[model samples]
Target: MRINKFIANSGFTSRRKADDLIIQGRVKINGQTIYEPGIQVVDGDKVEVEGKLLTIEKKFYIKLYKPVGFITSNFDPYNELDLNDLLDIDKRFFAAGRLDKDSEGLLIITNDGEFTNNLIHPKFKLDKEYIVKIDRKLRASQEKKFEKGLDIGNGEKTSDAKLEYLGNNTYSVIIHQGFNRQIRRMFKVLGARVIELKRIRIGKIFLGDLKEKEYKYFSKDELKFVDEMIR
Candidate 1:
């Protein structure tokens, strides 16, 4: 298997992260630093990342209905609530993407680096859906501007998005990119503030009626969709 794939299969991190480790001279093959990403490795060959021996582990696909006040983080120095604290799973799994500490909803957790890479990688254009409540109702002009794309400063602009009003000040939106605080920024530019934001969908996986802070193993059918999504 390729070095990056080997490291990812070992469940240490993502393939892209493995490549970074290789470039940084942190990855070694049989005691020699291996920087070539495509280099093949055999079952007998020793592989290490930062002096830690690489070993494969069972991969898991989990979905959690994250609630507000829990941050999607590996660690929190302040000892605040984190999504990992809510999980009762045995193995260490990382969130495919993230929801801010204030925001909440469906979160994907997995040990499959390739899947994470593909889902978040810019090339794949995976769809993410969010239900948002703004401080005020949005106008048709503002919705059109959002659909056309919003300039969120920093020389960055949002991609074309699909928007739907869900009554009152609430709305549903779908976007293909995972920009940081994107939904908030979009509404901010239109003179509104996002008071509540919750992700309900990623690709074909939906939150359905999953209660907050509860998680379930990904169904085989859902896993198949994830594979088909990246392909």
Candidate 2:
């Protein structure tokens, strides 16, 4: 198998991240540091990432209701709260998709690197649904502009989005792109500030009754749609 895939299969991280490690000379095969991501590995060849031996770990798929004030990462430089603290599982896992520190809602946690790549890759075009509360009511013209797309600075125009106006300055927004602070940036261009943002769904997976700081393993039925999509 390719070096990146081999590392990913070992449950260290996603293939993309593994490639980064290879390029950074952090990956070694039999004590030889390698800078090539495409190197092949065969049986009996030992691999080490960051000087730690790699081993295929049991895979886990979990859905978590991430609350505000927690970063969706394994480490934070400023010593802020991390989502991993809420999970009691002993296995190392990472978020498939991320929510900003101020945002809250559904998040997928897993140790399967291939699965993470497939779920977040733009080519799949998975629908991500969010509930956004802005500082003020949305105007008709602003809504039209938002639906058509806007230039959220740096000459980057957002794609067309679907929006449903719920009562009290809240709206249901659906987007496929996973740009950084995308929903918030889209609203900012229309003279609105997102007061609260919560993701409620990703494709067919719903947050449902999952409360903040709570998580559960994906049931067989829930995995059905996800598996079919990634495949």
Candidate 3:
């Protein structure tokens, strides 16, 4: 099979990212550096990524309610906080997307690299819902701007969004894009200060009574719904 396809099949990265690994000289085939993207590999050929043997076994998929103050990374060099410390596992897993340190809500940690790509890529157009509380009252004009997409710091405008006011400084907003600190930035652009932000849903999966700092695996039906949505 082609080198890129082989790397992708190993579940190390997507086909596009696999090409990057080849160009960076991080992938080797048969004990030789294989920088050519179109190189072929056969059975009995040894494949290594960044000097570690690549294996396609023991994939894991899990969901957790990420609490405030905990970083989303598997390890944090500065704060010495690691998400894995909360889980009982020896396998390596990565967060599919991200929730900022100050934000709290549903987060998926998994070893299934392919599922991570499909879930995060914009082509899937899956919706992520959040309930946020702001310090200032939302004005009517600001509400229209959110529906039409606002200029939130980036040179690009936010994608169309669904916003509903829940009264008493609370509102529910659903967005398709997962830009960095996107929900918080949008509110800031409207001259509002966010007091709290929590993601409540990802696609058909809901936070579902999971308390802060709590965790649970995706149910069979929830996993099936996600698979069908992306497929």
Best by TM-score: 1
On residues 1-231, what C-alpha lDDT tens digit does candidate 3 reach at each position? 888867766778877788999999999987899788899988888889899887556555677898888888887778655586667768777888889989999898777666788788898888999999999778999998987898877586798999999999999999989889998889888899899999988888788998977788878887896567434
Q: Write down the lDDT of every candidate, Cα atoms only.
A: 0.87, 0.89, 0.83
Clashing pairs in 1: none
| Clash totals, every prediction | 0, 0, 0
Residue 146, candidate 1: how far off, in angstroms?
Answer: 0.7
Cα deviation of 60, candidate 3, in Å: 1.8
Per-residue lDDT of model 1, residues 187-207, tens digit only: 999999999999999988888
Q: Which regions of candidate 3 deviate over 4 angstroms? A: 1-6, 15-52, 229-231
lDDT for model 2, please.
0.89
Q: Please write out the lDDT profile of model 2 over residues 1-231, one tens digit for every residue.
A: 899988878878778889999999999999999999999999899999998999777777889999999999987788889975788877777899889999999999988878887788888888999999999988899998898988888767788889999999999999888888999999988889999999999888899999999999999988897568545
Local lDDT at 86 for model 2: 84
Measured against the true structure, the TM-scores of the candidates, in listed sequence, are 0.87, 0.80, 0.81
**Which candidate, 2 or 3, has the higher lDDT?**
2
Among all windows of 10 consecutive residues in model 2, the one with the lowest summed lDDT is 222-231
Spell out the clash pairs found in candidate 3. Answer: none
- RMSD, candidate 2, Å: 3.7
Q: Of the candidates shown, which would achieve the greatest lDDT relative to the real structure?
A: 2
